[model samples]
Target: MKQSEFIPLTLITGFLGSGKTTIIKNLLQREELSKTAVIINEFGEIGLDHHFIETSDEDLVELSTGCLCCVMRGDLQEAIARLLTKREGGWSFDRIILETTGMADPAPIIQSLVLDKISAPKVILDRVLVTVDSVTGLKSISEFEECSRQVAFADILLLTKTDLVESVEGSLEKELMHINNNAEIFKSDFGIIDLELVLGEYKRQTIAFTENEIDKHSHSHSHSHSDIMSVSLYFKKPIHAVALTLFLELLAEVLGSDLIRLKGFVYIKEAPETPAVVHGVQHIFHPIEWHQSWPYERKETQLVLIGRNISLPWVRAILETIEEEVEETTRQNEN
Candidate 1:
């Protein structure tokens, strides 16, 4: 909230055509992002998104960090310093959004932001927003380590193309829960999600590996990149938010070693429609945080998994039992 503190930046990443372009294009229209700057990396020779962007104020700058996972540190640090210079020169820049190339990996890009250079640190990583196609998320996860990593490392996982993925939603939902029980997953059609969800000036903190955060929900599920990776499960409605949090803590604890990342937007029996998101690294899990409001047209409990070998039956049972216990507790409270 302090204006003098450095702004929080979000890394937007996903596979090619996962609607990263579409999302960014619409995002620029948001009045909240008027002073927000964009640092986009293009893998191909010609940058297609540039044509769609109409930035007369010069807030949008293009910086190509060739092979995001490789030279991300150097390129990002230089770009941040350049941005500071530009701002000092009269053009003021507020927040930053780094749109990584489709094939990019998000971990190093996120890890690098917190680090200092010759001049200073590049920037603070407020959160990571990942765009995933409702249709191809599973396939992408099965084939690419980057896809899995992108989802795993995200603070917010935005599910794009949900209308085009009604059939696969069930499967994707299951996989999402097994991998990450903590992340808030928003399903968007036509690349629609509130800018508040995408853009935030939240203070950046490293993923903490405290015993309480990782001691519960302990399990491991991993798959080689070549395997088919997706799962879905159902739970009886109305679970206490506290129990759900406990389940996630346990889930992160068990899967922490093997988990690349975990995320979901759940409707607790206590707070329906208002979703909470969870983000975790390998063995390090952050606490669940509530969203300001629902961004999507609909609200339902849905979790998206990006890891492999995450079991359907085990996760399903775990979630169901957690809810059952929580519901019983709620019933007793009312009595």
Candidate 2:
């Protein structure tokens, strides 16, 4: 399909009380979203009327019957079709944003767009933006599968209600990164954030890691929640391609579902000029993105893996073995 013909559709999802509506309410007030149509799907009896979005004949839509990911799946596709038809009929909009129910899983919604014959042509899946409430997120992730899946599938993770907390102390941030390393984390207050940050060029959305953030997490945190934990590894030297490849392959084979997500920037010895951006969900690894240059001052490898019932020491040992083999091979070649 031609890029010009495809309309970008972004998914705004989160667990219960993660502030999805609050963020969309603020976004609709922006000029950038003036041409955007919205589909709000809520579970149970909650309504969108509280958001105060100015409802016109065609601008807003709501679906309430269980969750869009399950019961309302057909309604979601129909809503997209209806909105597109409205655009063709003269009520114009450049894009669409679907705000999913707090209890919904977004994977099926995403699958519908990719598999559906009609909607697939008209709409393009743009981004998955998930909001996690900073105050109550830890308990939520530990207690809920829906919450973790929301985090795992997001392209960007926005932390809301940050004002309610004294300091995030990099604790929440670390947990989020482990859940989905591919997503760049951002903090929000009252769900207010720049529209440009949300709708801007996503390729340049790498989070700038500061020395303080690195220092704060110099030592890993102890987790009482054994089901979910994140292991962060850093390498000062560029990794050999063979070693990196072997490490990823072995993990994907052994860990599989236990490995929820893997995302990081790796400086490849083969391509020192350009760094490799890796993204993996479960066992499936997407094509590695090679950035033209490092996005931050720290030109080192940083990987955060979020998994359930995974051993950090075993993971570390595998990586150490790979690096040693690479070094040994390098010395042999030199001699």
Off by over 4 Å in 1: 1-3, 117-122, 200-335
* Candidate 2 segments whose C-alpha is farther than 4 A from its true place: 1-6, 44-52, 61-65, 70-91, 106-127, 152-189, 203-220, 223-226, 235-249, 267-272, 297-301, 311-313, 316-335
Clashes of each: 24, 0
What's the residue-level lDDT of 68 in candidate 2? 85
Cα-based lDDT for every prediction:
0.65, 0.76
Per-residue CA lDDT of candidate 2, range 93-131, in tens?
888888888888766787676555786446866778999
User: Candidate 1 residues 234-333, lDDT tens each?
Assistant: 3436567887777776777676645554545666767775666655444344456777676554565555444555775777678888777877887899
Clash pairs (backbone) in predicted model 2 = none
RMSD of 2: 5.0
Q: What is the TM-score of each candidate against the true structure?
A: 0.62, 0.70
Global local distance difference test of model 1: 0.65
